[model samples]
Every structure is written in structure tokens, then in C-alpha cells.
Target chain A: MKVESLVFMLITFAVITLITVSLFIKVLKNNKNSDEISEEEQ
Target chain B: MPKNEQWGTRVGLILAMAGNAVGLGNFLRFPVQAVQNGGGAFIIPYLVCFLLMGIPLLWVEWTIGRYGGSHGNHSTPFILDKMGKKFFWKYIGVFGIFSNIAIAAYYCYIESWTMSYVYHSLIGTFRGMDQSQVAGFFSDYLDVFTSTTGIPYEAIIFYIICLALNTWILSRGLNAGVEKTAIIAMPLLILFGIFLAIQGVTLTSGSRGAVFDGTVGLNFLWTPEFDSLLNPKVWLAAAGQIFFTLSVGMGSIQCYASYVKSRKDIALNAMSAGWINEFVEVVIGSCVIIPISIGYLGIDKVIELTTTGGLGLGFRTLPFLFQQWGDLLAVLAGVSFFGLLFFAGITSSLAMGTPLMGFLQDEFKFNRQKSALIFGAIIFLMGMPTVIFFNEGVFDEYDYWAGTVSLVVFALFEAILFAWVFGIDKGWKELNKGAEIKVPYVYKFIIKYITPLLLAIVFIGATIRPENDDWSKLSFSGWELHNESIIGQLIHKGIKYNNTYFSDYFKSEVDGVVDSVYHFKGRDYILISYIDEKGLTHTVSYNYSGNELTVNLGQIVNAGDIIFKGFVINRIFYIDMARLLLLTMFISISVLVYIAAKKRKQEKENK
Candidate 1:
């Protein structure tokens, strides 16, 4: 691939990966928070 | 208010919405559209439309769904009635119902093709087949012209299987069925797309005179023609792509959103789904299809193949290219690729069922399982014409009218009702009600005015442009004029001047040895035999366009004086007329129904 095209691909891949990872982490964090609140109530 | 079903989880909702948006279009359609509409320059209008049309419409649909759901309105008609003070809005909402049912019928049939292709690829059916034979395989599968298997039993069988699978999934209810399938399928689709893209880019050298790598393909795609941005056609194409890729204007998004909790954060979720879809489309979609095809067929041939549209790229050309990778590797690649397409197709096709299920449950009080089965059966019956008459323009007719035209129409209705009649301030407040990210205040004005106007323009422009008319004819003409060899051959063969006109003399030149004649609309085309200076015989044809004859046969001429004529013929075909009349009748009847219902309701109140 051309250097510019390769750069473009890498940038796009990184951004998508970051967004997906962040979303998953957020979901996990929310789950943990809910679990903690239930434990406190118990 | 009726008790509405809610999504099992926020993650499931987002994934389901994303899967609904991401489909065969993301992989097969976007890359071809981008390349054909001036490559990187296409992105300018594309991004513009995404901001002006796509994002705003996503918010509109989501907000409408949540708001309507809070009040026990899951279907568009009920949702629209609740939003708009007038009953006419509910009637306008019928577009959503009609569009979903109409699109789902043919869409499931297409999904079946992908499923069949997966099985064919897995079993190595494409192996050892030459390009012509590979092309013929798909043609025969569609039973176009002549059937290779004597009957279209395979098509019917696979189609029924696809319908059953979709119905079974949908019958399982929202969380267990659609959401669960999307959670599995969407991730696999992305992974498969990425894997194929990696393989595509790594292909440095190709066989069979395809001497280029993936870079050539990427360059072809990313290279921008700045001038093309000025063209209205490019803008229209970009806007249409956004509408299609985002799955906006269809009532499915609203139906999906209705399943969300009334207080859930839709703005952030909508944005997330949109971004994910774009990532799949622009990044993975472009990365895989274009580069791989270019690596296998060279850029020129890939470009030529793309002009034949999505089916040519996905079904025929890609399978042929896979076979070029030798034996075992070809089978592996073919299975993975077709498998990816099957997943993508099913994910989206499942969404098409949602609006119907929601409508039935919301209106008739049918249970989810019963609704799913009845809807599936109706679609199976409705889709029969497409399968039985695969070669006879039935599929194209449904696809063009229901899938393409009605999408824009319904979207326009949505924008107007949400932004204008329902009131933009109210819509904006609803959009921001459970938002994680704050949408800019200016979008309120944009949603109210600009988006609707743009959609109106697109609707009118598409109406004016003839369906099935090839826009590339002008480009071909321009290319022929620029090429010395082609122009020289034409001049040498033709004894006279080349201009756009229909004369009886030119018609007489090919009348003597005419082999066959076909009539389309009011025009007669004659195919005649001619001999060159080398004594090689060939068949050439000319079209009679009522007032003039325009011939642009690429290289069919052997020897004869032929004058090429161009004229602006605005003749409407029967299909176009029927489509226009149907749309007009639908809207008119809707208006009449609204008025009659309103009168009856008012009388009841007075009594």
C-alpha cells in the first residue's frame, strides 16, 4: 500500500478499536457499579 | 397507556441498532458508490449529508420511538398520530408500514442468495471454473434467461430456508432473538471484514495480468477529483448513500428504538451506532472490496466490474477472484467472504421484520410469536414474484420502487412531521431528554429547515431521472471522443459525419440484412449484419428514439456508415408511469382516509 493510504488505514483502525474498547469498558464499569449498589442494599 | 416491551440491556439495544444499520450495502454498495462518484471527493458531500441528513434523522427516529413508546405507540402510524395533532400524520405514517413490508419481501430473497453462495463457496462449487463460467454460475442461480438445473428448485428451497431462519429468530422476541443474533453476528462481520481486508492489502502481486497491489486500489478510492464536488449528481449520490447506509427513513429504526426504556440515553447510543456503521463501511468496507478486486483484476477491470453494480461485485467477480487464489486457499477465502455476507445480510434482513412485528403487536394485539409467523408467511407469498420472475425485471421493480424511491419519500415525511408539524423545539427537547452528549443547538434549525429541503430536492431529482437509465453513457461517450483508435475506427467504418440525429437513410443502411428487431416503449431497434474491409462479418444495431437515433455501441461496428445521434428524450416507460401513479394514489387515499376518520371522530365527540 502507498504510505499515505497505509497511514489512513492505520488511523481509522486505531480510532475504531479505541471506540469499541471504550464502549465495552463503559459497559463493564456500569455493571460493576450496579453490582456494588446491590451488595450495599443487601 | 399500554405496557411496552423494553430492551434487555443497553448494550443489546446499541448492537441491535448498529446491526440494523450495517448490511450488505456497507460491504458491497458503499465502495462502488464512492469510487464511481469521484472517489475521495465523494466524501465531502457524503460527510455533509451525514451531518445535515443522517445524524439529524437518526435522532428524529430515535426520539420519536422513545416518545411514542412511552405512550404505548410502537408502530409509525400510532407514533405519528401521537406526535402530530392532525390525523393526516398517521395516514402519512402508512409509508413506513408499506416500505418495511415491501422491502422485507425482496430483501429476504436477496439474503437467501447470500446464504446459497455461502454453501456453494464452502463446497468449492466455484473452484476450477473460468471467469465466464463463474459469471454463468450466478446467472444460472438467478435462473436468468435459462436455468442450468432445469428448474429453480434450489432458489425456492434456499429462499424458504432463509425465511424460516428469520422468522424463527424474530419469533423468539426482541432480547432473545434479534438482539442475541446481532451480538454474535455483528462482531463476526467486523472480524471477517478486517481479516479479508488484511489479506487484501497483503496481496502484493496478482496472477492473470493483474500486476497491481492493494495500494493501487486504495489510491483509486482515496484520490479525489475536486471538480466532482461541484456536480449535483455526486451530491445526490452521497446523500442517498447516507440514507441507505444509516438505515434512516425506514420505520425499523423507530421500531427498534421503541424497545428502549423511555428515559434511556438515545443521543449517545444513536451516535455510537452511526460511528460503528461508518467504521464498518468506510474503513473495512472500502479496505476489503476495492483493494482485493483491484489486486485480482487490476484497477481498470475492477472499475468496469463496479459499473455493473453490487451483485456483479459481490456475487460474480469476487467469486471469480477467489478461484484465482489456487485451490485450498480459494475455498477458504470464498467461504469466509460469503459467510461474512450471509451474516451481514441476515442481521439487516432481521431488522426489516421488526417494524411489521411491532405493527402487528401494537395494532392487532398479536403475540410476538404469532406476529412473527404471520409476517413471515406474508413476506414469503409477497416475495414469490421476485423468485419466480427473477430474470423478468420483477426484482428490480420492487427494489427500485419500494427499496429506493419509497425510502426517500418516507424519510421526507419523517423530517417534515418531526421538524415542522410536530415542532422543532419540541423535537429538540425530546432528543436531548436522555442525552449523554449534547447536540449543538444549531441542529434544531437545520432539522427544521435544511434536512427536509435537502430530502425534498433528492426526492424530486430522483423522480425526474429515469429509472434504469444508465448515467455512465455520457462518460463512455466522452471516453470514445478522447480515444484516437476508437474514433478512427468509427470514422473509417462510417462514410459520413457523426452527429446526433434519426434519419430514414441511416435506418435503411441496416434494414436489408436485419437479423432481429425488438420494441421497447415506442422505439424500434434493428440488428443488422455488416462486413468490414477484412471480410469479417458482424452484427450492429441502432435505436430509433422517435425523433432521433442515438447509437453508442462500444465496439460492435465492423464496417458501415453510422451516425451517432444524441437527444433529450423525456419519454416515460410503463413501469415509471405505474410507479408514479401508485405513489400518488397511495398518498391521496391516505389523505382521504385521514379526513373521513377525522369527521367520524368529531361526530362521535359531538354526539
Candidate 2:
């Protein structure tokens, strides 16, 4: 890939990682009480 | 404002979006502009805009629209209020309303031309005319129609009919009018397109000449002349075409998406329409524009001839070419061609009117009927200039200001506001919910970066003011050179379809493909070459023989027999490699990410 494209991919990876982390953190906070149901179901 | 009780169904919302996106931009502008600005080269930037610009902007519109609808508000200002922006940005909403109205005004008038052509073609008045004569006929018709007492009556009558139909549908609300028309028109357009493709093939058999001449057909389409590509003017045109073609940033889509339920997936729908539009432009559109142009102007001058004017390129040129080929086949092709055009014009015009009507109802609290009528009246009255003057200067002005500049600026502001101000995270939650396919993490990546970058490039590139051409210049850059060849050739060959008449008059006299050996046979032909795995070359002749390809291989050809072919040799099969790779990458990444995230969640729960 060209330098420009490589840079774009890096930027994309960073953005997606940040967003996923943010969402994951939010999901954990919102569903903290539901963790017992998850473990029991498993 | 009324509650969400009157909004469109999911299907209605999809249709409204499709209706807005798939208008004259697809049918009228794309084919002409693609040929004019270096065919395959033009697609490069266009694809970039779609991948980077169009999809993201659509997502922004959908997110904002659904959010605002839940609160029952209209456009940028209403939505921004909740997003914590001050009243100053409400100006964007007002600007959007003006842009839509301006677009509709001229769009309706151009739409009227289709109705007029349909009436003329159906009545057999366009039959048996040479180029100049046909040109004269159109000019005379325009003169008679635009005069205080002239053919403007017919134009007005149809204009009102189309306008009333639009208003009546909008008044019926989204499902009854907008969605219904989209579903019906979409199918009809496809069916009619198939019919036109069928007719186009049949026209290949008669005496016209080499139908595959690239001068206007495939050569003008795919042949890359790098000089044209490198020109800043070409890039500007490509940017302008992308902006106009997708209907992005127009509030046309935002207004329609406003009616969509929060759960309905806007991104997927927008992508679907965008892909369909690209397919039609490259495949069906190229098939029509190139073959017809090659048959008339030859390969070299095809570019020159098509560069005259966008409307003149397809509307005036193709009809005259059909007349020249003269026969039962020609007559059928002529009717199908115009019918296809009429369908395209109507679908697009409806989309243009939607945003105008929506803005009025949302901002001013006008009922659907009142909004539709008042908006429709304004469009009809404004369209008068295009109808009455018969000059492209006014049309060009409207197209430039409302179609390109205003639309993109609005779209850019929308993207910025959605991604940064309103917050991208909220959009993700709504988009992900109930998606049959799990939302890939990369979508977030695209939304934040790829899409915004593309829009910025297209918007900035499009607004680059031309240094050479004055805004007031009436003459198109390439018009004189192109039109001269057309007139000169028409004068030399007086007959429309009679090969004997043309050959006798112009034989040994003209320079282009007209003097070549292939004149009488309608120039649409196909040459198929297959190189097998064993290094054996198979050359075949495929020509339109009575509405079907008559394939002669000079060897035994068997159906359902395993003929081991080593390599697929067509340009058609090769060009799709990049898009296929991108699709695969996207799918694979999404799947892997989803699986990894699910597993991580399971581990965390166990802990």
C-alpha cells in the first residue's frame, strides 16, 4: 500500500479501537447487575 | 408539529431515500458527464467520493433524522438544538430549504421536456429526419412551445400534470405517495430499461457500420487519456458530478430519512442504492451512450460530439441517430429510449420536490397538502425560465448553485455536526440494534475518518472556481469543435437511415467512420475472444441478430458441456478486482471482530 493508504489504515484502526473500547466500557457500566445472569447461563 | 403518527412505513422510507438518490443525476447527468470527462477516469474520483463521502454523509443524515423525528423536529436547527448548538446554526436549515426549492424549480422544467419528447416520438413526428432537420424540428418545437401562444401550452400542461401528481402524492403522506411511487417507478424503470437494452441490441443488425467504434462507445468510456485525467478541470467535473449524482448534502435525503423509524437501517439502504446507481452508470449507461455515439460520430470524434451540452448529448443526439437508422427496429428503439428517459426524469423530479415540501411543512407548520401545493406551484413558476428561454445558461446557473455548491456545503456541515457535535457513539447504537448482520467495528472507523475525508475532497474540489472560463460565458468550452463535426457530417449525408442515399451522396468525400466499410450495418457489434487453459485462442463473432446475439465461433459450441477455459479474458471481468477485495476485507474484518468481541465478553463474565 502507498504511504497515504497505510496512514489511512492506521487511523481507521485507531478510531475503531477507541470506539469499541468506549462502547465496551459503557456496556459494562450499564449491565453490571446482569453479570450474574451471564455467568449462571454459561 | 404533529406526532410521529403520520410518518412513513419502513418500506416507504426506503423508497423515499431511493427516489431522492436515483433521479436525473443517475439517468441524465451520469452517462453524459462520464463520457465528457474521460469515462473510466471519471469513475476513479466518483468511486472515491462514494466510499469516503456518500455513505458517511448518509449515516449522518439518518442518525440526525431519526433522533430529531423522535423529538418531532425539522432539519439542522431543530436537531442541533438538542445537540447543544445555539440558534445561529438554524441558518443552515433555512439555507437547505432555499436550496431544495431552487433545485425543484429548474428540475421540474427539465422534467417537462421528457413529456414533450414522449408525445412527439409516439406520434411518429420524429421519423425520417436528417441531423439538421431533426435539430431544426426540436428548435422549432421549442420556439413554438415557448412563444406566448406556442408549444409552451403542451409543456405547461404536462408540467402541471407532473407537479400535481407530485403534490397529490406528497399530500397523501410518505407511504401513499413517496414510497408507493418509488416502488412502482423503480420496478417500471428496471423493466423499461430491460426493454430498451433489448431494443438496442436489435438495432445492431441493420446497415449502419461498425457498432463497436470506441470513438463514442467503449473508447470514450474506458480509454484513459491521462492528460484529461490530470487536468484540474476534469477533477472539478468529477467532484461536481459525484456531488450532483448522489444527491448528498441536499437535505433531500435528510427530509426523507426524517420520516424513517429509528430502527430502520439507513447506511445499508444508502449503500444499496449507491451500488445500484454505479452499476447502472457503468454497465447499462455505458452500453447505451457509447454504442449510440460510436454509430453516429465514430470513435475519435465521439468525445468531441458528446462535449456539446449535457442535455443535448443524450436527448437530442440519440433520437437523431435512431431516425438515421430508419426501419421498424429504429422506430421501436426510439420509443423505448424516450420512455426510459421519461421514467428517469419523473423519479428524480419527485425526489427534488420532497425536501422542499418537507421543509415547508416542518418549518412553517403547513399541512402536507398545503405544503405540497404551495411548493409545487413555486417549482412550476420557477421552472418557467428554463422552459421559456430554451437556453442552457439559466439551467447551468441553477445546476451549479443549487445542485453542486449548496448541496455539498449543507452535507459537509451535517457530517461535522453528526460526527463531532451530536456524537458518533449514539449513531452506532441505533445502527447496530436489530441488524441481521452484526455491525462491524470498522464502520466506526469509516464514519469517523474515511467518509469525512472523501466529502471534504469532493466538496472542496467542486467549488474551485474556474480561472479560464468566465461564469457569464455562454459558449461551452468544446461546443464549437464538436457541433461543427456533427453539422458537417449531417450536411454531407442527407438521409437518416437509407444507406444507399447516404453512401451515394457522401462516398469518397467524408473522413470519419462514415467513409469506412461498415456504414450501413448498425454499428453495434461484439467481438469475443477466449484464450483457454491450453493456450488455445477462440475468436468469435457476436452481433445483434434480430434482438439476440448471433454467436458464430467457426467451431462446434455445445451448451452444458464442460469446456475447460484457462483464463477469463474480458475487460468486464478484470476491472471488478479492487471492489471485490474491499468487500472481502470489510466482511472478513467484521466477522473476526464480532467473534473476538463475543469471546472477550464471555471471559470477562467468567471472571
Candidate 3:
């Protein structure tokens, strides 16, 4: 691949992957926190 | 709010929503769209549209769904009905239900091809076949009348099995049915995607029988046409991609969102689903078909194959390329590739069934199992023409109207309803109800203003596509319609230089009742269409139009009788009939909605 093309491809992929992973982790953490809260209430 | 049936878990809900958005388009259509609409430069507009249009629409659809679900409504018709006070709101919602049923009809048929390919892959049907022979395998499958492949009525059989599978899952209810299937399928889909993408990027020129470097294809896909960014059409193309790719406008997302529990974080959930689809499209989608195909066939052949469509490239070409990897690996590649498509297809098709099932259950008091069966039967009936007339133009007709046009129309309406009609203030509150991640405040203005304006641009750009795709050069001085434009498609009016395609035949209005059509041509033929008392019909190589030798067929045609039968080439009635069938289906669904609302009114009065 040309350097410019490779750079374009990498940046696009990295940005999307970053956002997806971040949102996924945040959602998981929120779910875990709720489970802990309910467990404490129990 | 989530009274009837709720998603089993947060993960399941997200997966289910993701599964709905992440479909065949994510893997197949996205790359082709990127290639056609300016390659790497396309991503800028794509991301911009994602923020301005796709994400905002996702929030709005979810807000409408949860609002409706809170009011004991789960379908688009009743949801829109509840959201807006006007009666016509429910009618606009008809696109959600009708488009699903119409689209599901042929969509599941295409899904069946994936299942059949999986079967063929496992059995090694293409083991020793050459290129044309491999391509012949697909054509044979499409020719429903023939039974060359040992499976008699092969197309119909697979279609039944696919529909049955969808119906069975839908019958299992939302939690067990859609959510459970997503939990399993989405993960496996990702795995297959990752595996195939790895194989694609690692492709060497001579390694694994690759004819060219796979990385070369990646370059072709990623190389930006900076010049194309200056064109308005590129932006419209990007906007259109965001529109279809996120699977908004179609009632499927709204129906899925309606099941989400009240006070659950819809904002985060919608974001997760939308971004997951984007990840699959941009990262995984770009990695697979185009790279591998270019690696094998070279970029020139790959570009040529795209004219047949992404489905063609994925189905007809990929198998032959995978065959170069030797037997065991070829089988694995085929199974993974086709199996990935099957899961992607089923998840989306399953989304289509929900709004119909919701309508039946909430309105007519049908149970889940019964509703699933009815939905299955309706598709089976609607799908038959597309299956039998697969070679003819019936399938494309359904896809053009129901799948493409209906989606844009519905999305436009929903955006208007959510922001303007329902009041953006309430809709914004609805989006941020639960205590998860707070949505940024800028979306408040974007949702109300920017998204709808972009949607209108997408709509106009699609319908009245400018000449040469140059919006600046567009002029009304010598205006001529492109056959592909919406208005041109509606009336079948355009200057078709090629006579190979069927729907290209212009359906003409009655001018003088066709005095006579004289047609004879050696090299090329121009189809001149005119209407008589009977209806639409066309003539090729007529004396009045283009062509040298003209032979009048007045003696064969009775003077008093209608000269033409409103048909052309081979698929005379089927194309027109397909349009009629979809129109009838839309009206029928709308009628059902009206009757459902009336029954609800009666029940309330009695109470």
C-alpha cells in the first residue's frame, strides 16, 4: 500500500475501533456498578 | 414501559440492536459505496453524516419507541400515532411496517442463497470447477425452473428453510428470539469477520495463489480522491451510505428499541449499536471482499465485477478466489464467509418481522407464535414472484421501491415527527432518561436543525441526480432525465443508450394510440414505448426512433384492438405487477392500522 493510503486506512479504522471499545467498556462498567448496587441493597 | 417483554440483559439488548444495524450491507455494500463515492475521502462525509444524521436519527427512533412502549404500543404505527396527535402520523408509520414485509419477502430469498452457499461449500460443489462453471452455479440457482444441482426446486427449498428459521426465532419472543440469536450470531459474525479480514490483509502476490498483492486492493480502496471531495454528489453519497448503513428509516430499529426497558440508558445503547455497525462497515467491511478480490483478479477486474453489484462480487467471485487457497482452507473460507452473511442477513430479517408481530399482538390480539406464522406466510406469498421471476425485473422492483425509497421516505418523516412534531425538548429528555453516560448538549441543536436538512439534501440528491454527478454544472437549459433517477424510474422516462436492461424500456403515455410500430435493426435498437387502450407497451428499432430498416407490423395488429399490452422484452407484466403488489400491500397494512386504532377506540369507550 502507498504510505498515504495506508495512513488513511489506519486512522479511519483506529478512530472507529477506539470509540467502539470505549463505549463498550463504559457500558460494561455501568452494568457492573448496577449489579453491585443491587447486591448491596439485597 | 417495558411491560410485555423486555430484553434479557444489557449485552443482549446492545447485541440485538447491533445485529439489526450490522447486516450484509456492513460487509458488502459499504466497501463498494466507499469505492464509488471517493474511497478514503468518503470517510470524512460518512463520519459527518453519522453525527449529523445517523446518530441523531438513532436517538430519535429510540425515543419514539420507548415513548410508544411506555404507552403500551410497540409498533411504528401506534408509536407514531402516540407521539403525534394527527391521524396521518400513523399512516406515515405505514412505511415502517409495509417496507419490512415487502423488503423481507425478497431479503429472505437472498438470505436463502447464503444458506445454499454454505451447503455447497461444505459439500465441495465447486471443488474442480473452472471460472465460468463457478459463475454458472449461481445462474443455475437463480433459474428456478431448472433443477441441475441435484436439489429440485433448490431456490424455493432454501427460501422456505430460511423463512422457517426466522419465524421460529421470532416466535420465541423478543428476549429468547431476537436477543438470544444476536448473543450467539453477533459474536460469531465478528469472529468470522476478523478471521476473513486477517486472511485478506495478509494476502501476498504469489502466496496462497494470489495473483496480485492483497495490500494493493487496500490501497485502491483507501487512496483518497481529493478532487472528489469538492463534488456535492460525494457528500450526498456519503449521507446516503450513513442512511442505509445504520438501518434507520426502516421500522426495524424502532421496533427493537420499543422493547428496551423504560429508564434504561437508550442514549448509550443507541450509540453502542450505531458505532458497532460503523466498526463493522469501515474496519471489517473494507478489509474483506475488495482486498481479496483485487488480490486475486487485479483491481481492473474487481472494478468491472462491481457493476453486477456487491452481492455478485461476494457470491460469484469470492468462492472462486477462495478455491485458490486449496481444499481445506477453501472450505473454511467459504463456510466462514457465507455463514457470516447468513447471520448478518437473518438478524436484519428478524428485525423486519418484529413490527408486524407487534402490530398483530398489540392490535389484533394475535399471539407471538401465530403472528410469526402469519408474517412467514405473508413473506412467502410476497416473495414467490421475486423467486420465480428472479431473472426478470421483479426482485429489483421490490428492492427499489420498498427497500430503498420507502426507507428514505420513512426516515424523513420520523425525523420531522421527532424534532418538529413531538417537540425536540421531550425527545431529548427521552433520549437521556437513564443515568448512564450523558449525551453531549450540542446534539440538542443538531437533532432539531441539522439532521433533517441533511436528510432533505440526501433525498433531493437521490431523486434528482444531477448530470455527470456535478451539481455545479447542473442546468435546466437542456434537462434530460437519467433513467436511474426516482422520477425517471417512476414514469420509465429516460434516454437509454443500451437496450440490454428490461426496465430501461420507457412506458409511454397514449399519444395517438400507436398508429403502427415499424421496427428493424442490425446493430442497435431503440425501444419506443406508447400506450394504447390496453396499456403500456414498447417498440424496438421503430422508424420514428433510431435504426435503419423499418418494417411496419400493422397487418399483424388489428386496427380497432389495442396495439400494445403495456409490456416490453421478456418481463411484460411481472415488473408492473410487482409494483402493483407492493402498492396493494402498503394500502392493506395502512387499512389494518386504521382498523386497529378503531378497535382501540371502541375498547376505551367500553371501559
- Model number with the top DockQ: 3
Error of 3 at B368 (Å): 0.4
lDDT per residue (tens digit) for residues B171-237 in model 2:
7766667677777776666566666544443444235643543223444455555666566556666
* Candidate 3 lDDT by residue in tens digits, B1-607: 1237877678788888898888888888888888887888888888888989999999888888888887888889989988888989999999989989998999999999999999999999988888778887887788786666888899999999999999999999898888899999999999999999999999999898888887988999999988888888789878878877888999988888887667667888889888999998899999999999999898767776785479889888889888999999999999999999999999999999999999898898888999999999999999999999877689999988998888888998899999899999888888889837788899999999998888887778678875556576567674555566788777665433223234323333223333444333222232333444545343432212331322233333322233233234535456678999999999999899989989989999999
Task: Specify the poorest-scoring 10-residue window by lDDT in model 1 chain B.
Answer: B481-490
What is the per-residue lDDT of model 1 for residues B1-607, given as tens digits with 9 covering 90 to 100? 1134566666677788989899889889999998899886787788789889998899999999888888777778778988987856888777776777777888888889888888888878887788888887787687633445444478888899999999999998887898899889988888888888887777777453356787788888877678888777788889989988998888888988887666667887887888788888887888888888888778777777786587788888888888777788777778778778888888888888877677667655689889899879978877876787655445766677778877898899989989888888888988998676778888898999999999998886665432222334344334222111223322332223222222333423432355566674355665767664545555655555543433343324333444433343211232243345446645653664466456647876999
Cα RMSD, each candidate: 8.8, 20.5, 7.3
Ranking by TM-score: 3, 1, 2
Task: Give the winner by TM-score.
Answer: 3
Ranking by DockQ: 3, 1, 2
Q: Report the Cα lDDT for residue B280, model 2.
A: 47
What's the true lDDT of residue B365 in model 3?
Answer: 82
Superposed Cα deviation of residue B56, candidate 3 (Å):
0.5
Query: Local error of candidate 1 at B61, Å?
Result: 0.6
lDDT, model 2: 0.55
Tens digits of per-residue lDDT for model 2, A6-38? 343244335434543453343334333334443
lDDT, model 3, position B233: 75
In candidate 2, residue B553 scores what lDDT?
A: 33
List, for all models, the DockQ compared with the true complex. 0.30, 0.03, 0.73
